[model samples]
Target: MNFRLFSQLSSYHADIKRLIKIALPILLAQIAQNSMGLVDTIMAGRVSATDMAAISVGASIWLPLVLFGHGLLLALPPTVSYLNGSGQQHRIAHQIRQGIWIALASCIPLGILIYYSDFALRFMQMEPHMAHIAQDYLHAMLWGLPAYLLLMNFRCLNDGIAKTKPAMVITFLGLMLNIPLNYIFIYGKLGIPAFGAVGCGIATAIVNWSMCLMMIGYSYFNRQERKLQVFSQIIEKPNAATLKKLLQLGLPIAIALCCEVALFAITALLLSPLGANIVASHQIALNTSSLIFMFPMSIGMATTILVGQALGAGAPEKAKKLSYAALLLGLTLTVVTAFITIFYRYQIAAIFVTDEIVIGMAATLLFLAAIYQFSDTVQVVVGGVLRGYKDTKVILYITLFSYWVIGIPLGYVLARTDLLMPSIGAQGFWLAFVVSLTFAAVLLFYRMRKTQSLSDDVLMARLEKLK
Candidate 1:
């Protein structure tokens, strides 16, 4: 019995090692991408509160729109993963073509929507100067929409093929470019006029195009990708069925993403009444937490690809093992990060802004943020696994229950203080966030288990048929 138990432990250890091999590079790449945004916010914060607010407001206007496109484009990775798993390389290319079409179709409406974001900010009660700065940023950034969507499609395709290293390399180069570009544009160095916050927008646009082109160039020149029939058929006619499938798969992700983003946007709007200091503090905490989240988020993305490919290859057991392995790895890493944040929360918050109130509030929120990290890691990894299984609808419903039904109500009661506790303010919201994520983690894991069980049954039945 001891030998058997040792064998089981060894198997589990091997699975985790495999997961790490697949997930670590993806995590690093995600961190690099996230750091770009963090650097932008930090640089903007250094200029002035007004500059920080401009970025916050600009993000409020831009992120939702960008995420909407991202959500729609998310359909590509899973589809490619599924096809690649089935050895359908030609179909992968066709899906890529369809994905490009979908991205283009969505960009027109999205561009128009984002273009008018400045006018929308006026209605949101932003100050004239702030609104102007935000408008300039939004308009400048809008130019990158096509490029951004294209890059996402390519990244997803590459990830589907289990090739994360190229994406990582491209993203790192983009980050390297972003700092100099931001410095040059924001400060008007190198004989350029200082564009301030607007410069961030321009720099972002350039990076988007550069990354997209670089990915395209790399895919074209690389022998591995070139050997795939899909690469050869880049200019093939679009298939309606393929488009429909992409849309079906992508729309829920888009809606789910939009809902979450809308929640943050609404929170920003609500906090606006509390004064700029409160909002600024909230943004600081939000930004910091978001950066930390990239660790789990990257693992989650890796989980989706790995699990999807496992399922596509008719290995439900392998998929299940991968999911658990990823979950364990994510939890371990997140716990370490949480400890770091807990011990140095104040010092970390100091990096963002100079305001004492902002720093104090952010520090308080960071503690709650630490508590949520475990739940966040679990939910994200499980969610990725579920996406791999094409069980996104269930996850979407779970998110609704956790975020809206439970989290928002609890936050309202705690933050506004009508019933349970006095106004704990933003910290109250963070506590609610922790609760919601915990519930989500439980539901997602349960669902993934059910799905895995079903998959196993199907596989057994298929094997019986073969006999």
Candidate 2:
């Protein structure tokens, strides 16, 4: 064996270990967050399908609404990591302060949207009882929106600085709180009247606030935070420039994310008119894919911090190595997941429902999902690195071109028309998804290769101009 090649291989293995070290906690945190959703759905279903529909409807209503705000905050981790790596940790306090302001400002529009959630349901022409429940549930959940947004900033601060374990612990804590509170409120533990699905919303709100308050306590007293003075100006007046910068950086990220989410959502809706079994199959496959996707997403998140820190420390070459290794890890895990999805698709579908037709369709969709896993992994991991690089607007542009301009149209044609090929239903759409994700991966990574080699000075200048 060549000595240099052996040494390089050993170094590569070490990078993978370091990548997993950071990502494992983030993966757990993301899973815990996902579990919160599952808990709500299962608990609500125990009440009635009507109750389940209410909460599901409420979730669908709010999910897109919150994306822009969340996206805005997504920029925080990398930006903070930049300061952290540069030894300018004192500046993070101001970032946190401005993030709070951004959070509060974001809440107002979201609060009003949730308050008028009735209009959304009514517009959909939903069943009256379900609509009322959904509206009320949304209203109840609104109480916690402030808490969720505030917590997100604090949480991102931790993520930015490579202190990821607290986020994992806090989310697990939220999960623990959710189940019991859900039981009590859902079943009327004391004098409180049972609000059914509304009770679930109430419980989630409580958990949201609890998590936020706990994070606050954690941040204030956490020795590192004190050293960095993250909470030093907890009540600083919101700076207009800072707030605008957050929005400018965040909105594109949000839009790009929403584009992908909307693609899936619209595909489901489009698939709905096909048949119940088709829709059910698509959903099962989608849900499973979503769960598996957390792995790469978590890896990407950790990559962002690692890359941002390297860049901030003025080590562009280190940033490049981190990004490359993280992408390799993402691709490797995706390949493993794809094989698992292929081998166990039928069994996975069996876990969801007992209907034979639904099972068959779901298994097939899972196969298609497996096929696209490679492309999906690339897009997500690359997107993460771009976020860390503070080159987020390009993400929005790339997603729009790939998803809307290319993927959606082709999927529509293949699903409904013989313009290019025979109509193939949901499977056809999934094929288009593969193409679009491939396109995004190719284009986005091309951009990365070009930008990744720039010295920290040049990249920092570009990042500063993003404001």
Candidate 3:
């Protein structure tokens, strides 16, 4: 018994080291990607709280919608990873090609939704000037939608094959480029008209196009990509059957993600009427938490790759062990981040805006954000491992219930009505986040445990379907 326990511990230790190897690049890449939001908040806030609010509101409208498409494409990585693990590399190029079709098909509808975002703004009942700024911000981002979608497809391709560094390098370059572009567009330098908050969207659009082009170029030149031949038959007609399978896998993931993101987006909108100070404060707290969130999110994403690969290699037991290691690692990292958030809440809030009222409010909210980190990390990481098992529908169902039914309603009652207590405003939403995420974490952990207990014969049946 002692020897067996020691061996298991040794295996877990090795798995964690491997998980971090894959996760670190993904973490840096996500940080670089989300830092653009931080940049937008800081730069836009410099102009005025209203401008910051505009970016916040505009993001609320577009991001969830955009991520809806993004979530759909996320189905690609695990699929590719499974194929790679199972020695079906010959089929990868065709799947990637079909994925590109999904990306292109998605762009038009998502763009159309974002194009008419003024309706959403109006529904939010924001002041007209703030509404106009948000509308303009959405419009500017439309140009980048296609590029962003295509870039995600390639990024997923790379991640599936465990080649995360290329995206890290490219996104870092994009971030480097975005800063200067933000300055030029926001401040109207180099003969460009100053677009204020709207400029963030424009700079991001340009960066998206640039990153997409760079990724395409990289894929063409990448040695592994050449071997995979992902681009060989660029114009192959879309297979209806293949596309259907992708959608069946992808749609649930997309809806699940949207369900969660929309809760935040709607919360932003609900907070809009309270004033720019409150909305900007909410953005600051949310942004800080989001940046910190990259750590666990990366861990989860890496787990999807690792778990899928392990299972593909006909090692269900290894995949189960990998999930356990990932969850432990994620919770450990969350503890560190939560501590950082607690200690530096005020200073972190100050990084975004100078308003004393906003800073104080944001600091309070950051404390609440800290409270949810454990639950948040568990749920997200567990969700990733489940994806590797192709157990997606439970994720969709659980997230929908937790975020929409439990969290949102509870939050609205606390934030907007006197039914629960006096309205706590933005703090109520953050409080609800803790509750919903805890519920999700508990349920997802249960689901993962159930998956881990599947008999070898059952597990083999699951893997057989991947063929």
Candidate 4:
């Protein structure tokens, strides 16, 4: 018994080390991407409260679009992983080429939407100056949208093959670039006039394109990548059958992300009627928690790659073990983050805003956010595992029901009405957020288990021809 137990313990430790190898780079990359928004909000807040408000509103406009495309491209990595695991390296170049075509087709419509999205302000009735600044932020940020999305495909390609460090290096470079560019454009360091919130948009757009180029350059020159010739088919025509499958897998992911993003956004929007301080406070709490979320999100991403590769190699037991290891790691990290968030909520809140009212309000919100972290960790890890199995449709259905059917409506009632006892203002929305994510966590956990039970047979049948 002792020897057998020791063997299992050793196996767990090895699996964890392997997961960390992939997850650490991904964690840095996720942090690099989320920090751009943090820096943008902080720099904009430094200029003026109105500037900060403009940023909050503008983020609501652009985030869903960016994340929607991102979620869609997520379908590519698992596809590549399956091929790689099955030793079908020859197909990767073709699959990547198809992803590029899909990205181009998707980005054009989104680019037009974001460019014209400035008109959405007419419906919001925000202050004239804030509205104008927000509009400029959206339009100025447009050039980066296509690059941002196209980079996701490249990143996915690298991630599928477990070459994640290049993505980390490139994204960290973007973060380094984002700060100086923000300082120069936002504060008018040279001959340029101070653009305030608009400067963030300009800086983001530039850094985004740079990251995309760097990823492309890395993919082009890497010795191993050259072995696969991932870009050799760059000029190939879009294969309809391939494109359809990519979209079929990706669109549900896209819609699920849209629903999740909308839940957060609408909470911000609904709280807008409360006051500027309320909206600003909510953004700070959301941003901080989101930064903390990157750790688990990266773990989930790594889990998907590992799990998919294992299943593709016809090792269902290995995949299940990988998922278990990932879940344990994610939960452990969240516990630490939750402690810090709850204990030092004030110190964290003060970093984002100067107003005492906003600071106080945000401290309370962060406490609730700490409680929400566990649920967030479970759901994110499970979702990644499900994505590895290509079981995205169930995720969409569960997210829709959890956030929309129950959570959002509950937030509305708790925040605005006395029916759920006394109205709790902005904190009420966050309270609802906790409940929704918990619901998602429980359901996603069940679905992931179900997928595991059925994944082996399904994956074996599908790839039997390849073998």
Candidate whose lDDT is highest: 3
Residue 52 displacement (Å), model 3: 4.3
Q: Which stretches of candidate 4 lie over 4 Å from their true place?
A: 44-49, 187-196, 276-281, 353-360, 462-467
For model 2, how many clashes?
A: 0
**Model 1 agreement with the true structure over 1-467: per-residue lDDT tens digits:** 99999987787788777667667778778888877887787777776667777887888767777888888877776667766776667667777777888888889988998898866887878688878888888888989989989998888888888888888899999999999999998878999998888888899999999999999888788887787754665466777877776776788888888888887777766666667877777877787788888888888888888777776677778888888888888988987999999999999989988888889988898888889999989998898888787667787799989999998888878877759866877777788899999999999889988777775777545322311
RMSD of each: 3.2, 1.5, 2.5, 2.4
- Ranked by lDDT, the better of candidates 1 and 4 is 4
lDDT preference between candidates 3 and 4, better one: 3
Question: In candidate 4, where is summed lDDT lowest over 10 consecutive residues?
Answer: 458-467
CA lDDT for candidate 3? 0.90
Ranking by lDDT: 3, 4, 2, 1
Q: Give per-residue CA lDDT, model 4, range 1-467, as digits (tens).
A: 99999998788788888889999999888887778888999899999999998988898889998888898898888888888887888888888888888888888878887778757887887799999999899998987888988899999999999989999999999999999999999999989889999999999999989999999999999998898887765598888888878887799999998778888878887888888888888988998888898889889989889887887787889988889998888888888999999999999999877889889999999999999999999999999998888778888998998899888899989998999689988888899989999999999999888767775667678544332
TM-scores for the candidates: 0.91, 0.97, 0.92, 0.93
On a 0 to 1 TM-score scale, where does candidate 2 land against the true structure?
0.97
Go through the candidates in order and give each one's C-alpha lDDT: 0.81, 0.87, 0.90, 0.88
Candidate 4, position 58, lDDT = 90
Q: Pull out the clashing pairs in model 1.
A: none
lDDT of each residue in 321-367, candidate 3, tens digit only: 99999999998888899999999999999988888899999999999
Q: What global local distance difference test value does model 1 have?
A: 0.81
Span of 10 residues, lowest total lDDT, candidate 2: 458-467
> Candidate 3 vs. truth: CA RMSD?
2.5
Query: Global lDDT for candidate 4?
Result: 0.88
Candidate that scores best on TM-score: 2
- Steric clashes per prediction: 0, 0, 0, 0
